[model samples]
Target: MSGGADLPGAAHLVLADGVAHLDLETAVFNAMLEGWARQQATRFLSSDGTIQPRISLVRRFASFTNEYPWQWDSADVEEFINHLRARRPSFAVSTGRGYQNILRLFCEYVTDARYGWPRKCYEHFGEAPVQILHEWNTVTHSSDYEGSPGRRPLTYDEVQGLFDAADGRVEEIRKRRRKGALAAMRDSILLKSVYAYGLRRREAAGLDVADLRRNARMPDYGRFGALFVRYGKSSKGGPPKRRTVLTVPEFDWIVDALDQYVDEVRPLFQPGKHPALWITERRGRISLRRVDEAFETARKVAGIPEELDLHCLRHSYVTHLLEFDYPERFVQDQVGHEYASTTAIYSGVSDEYRNRLLHRSLKGRHSALWGHCFD
Candidate 1:
């Protein structure tokens, strides 16, 4: 068949015209993946970050079944999911659901008449791919927040302890006349900035010096009044989202910390016109792994639980903003959440805040019931 414009995924375009190959089945399978990748890239505008993992997962499923997509069935999907669930450190419910969704999408693509994959497979192997994932066999999205319960917002004291530990590391290194004192100081400021701006790890790591913006209203904060986040998390099939995270009065301490880091400490790295806000010892932009390492080192020193991660700083930011009486919509916008429910999910307001809220509600509704009890 000639490659045609109307054919989805350009299945015929990817398959060799007249090549003699020893392993025809493998070649066909690779061609299917290549065609799928092209469809995702050209038609759907999917990034490599989104396409590569999907291709890898499809290959893994093929390996697990020891058969091609045409041979896959509901039973294979069930068994594969079970195998994943039974592994040590078992996959989370959301992760399993995501896997099922990807597999379902792939199956849909291959089985569709417009894709030409079904006919191609039938012509070659007398079998065609079928959708294997069904509601009964696949993991269901039963909860809004399926992330680990252990991953919660840190208490104010815990956040303080973590920052103190990071600062203490800088002192320890400086006293010993050791290397990494600058790095330790940078990490301290980085951790605080993550909380101050409610940033994801990538958002924090992706920051440039120019991302620090001046707010006309918050003139006191100077260049640290807001953060122009260029690498905000993207929706599926979209480029990185952008947002401006404004500085609030509660987290204004970050202004001085950032001012010091940008003006003095960051220069020690000799970045030589490097634009990255977080520079490494090598005068390169810091990586996400290094950000994690910085958090982990301080977490251990601060004696925080292992379950709490770098992301917890973000959670803490949301929770604290709510505690500080910020409007829900304001918090949602600050964190770049598309929905207020997502902001609520990240927030774990303190018992004290909840009690105060309850007290205020009761006082407002039943003024006589309180009888000056709150006072």
Candidate 2:
């Protein structure tokens, strides 16, 4: 009502208080999304997986509060987060923190002056968007590792049971002349591969035949001597990191397993041109979901605890390698950790391992004190 000139957009009919019409409010919202899309794109994030989720979170927050970003305040964030916490199967600390961080990033993007979202909001709504969520109002980072306390590395017996269960499933299917015998066999090897190499689910799913490499020192093992992991976890805006994990002596039996699967069984999948190491029955590459499903099936058969997951295999790998007296830095590099501390956090070494370390220290101290040495 105060403006003299008629604007071209749908919200040209402005109120005396300078608040935007509904259509203009919608348009500003769309523009905010567009700006966020460009920002994420510039940083090389996937539109569907990364940017869209953030957009949906903002939309869900707005729906919860019945308030647009321009009207949101710290209290709204607090209430919505509280609601999340109160819901059944409440968000874990890590998950809650992730959602809080996503909201904070969106607020930062919208309020940044260079993006012009704040300026446009002010012109249309008589107020600009503000950074509503702050550290005081949201979850704070307390530790590098904040996963469930119940989640832990599988012990040696548990790992052995899991592998035996997987192998047993393959035999059972084959005995019954079932259609899934080959698939079951593949799953058996897949789960072992995940633990043998300390692979994340995605990394195992993304493997290709060519990713298997020969180590000159371990030529007897041939192509199964090392794994070239091209899908190691990425940084915030970076492509997946790459690493070559040499076959450790403890898990060397994996070489025979891989040789059998690759030479004899993989061709049965009829994956002609597909180079993926793990092929589905449909002759396509295995997905990350399938990797988890395989691990879960084996876990249940092995009677492992329900809380343990595919990731626990990786944890088991780290812990077991340490138990074997492998150098800490060697284990870190094998797992493709960016820092030694990150590798350290994954370690949940068994009590037996600690006891062995204590015994070794006592024996060494006795050797220093006495004339004779004990083996």
Best by TM-score: 1
**Per-model C-alpha lDDT, please?**
0.91, 0.86
Task: Write down the TM-score of every candidate.
Answer: 0.96, 0.91
Pairs clashing in candidate 1? none
Total backbone collisions for each predicted model: 0, 0
Q: Looking at model 2, which ten-residue stretch has the lowest summed lDDT?
A: 7-16
Top lDDT: which candidate number? 1
Whole-model lDDT, candidate 1? 0.91
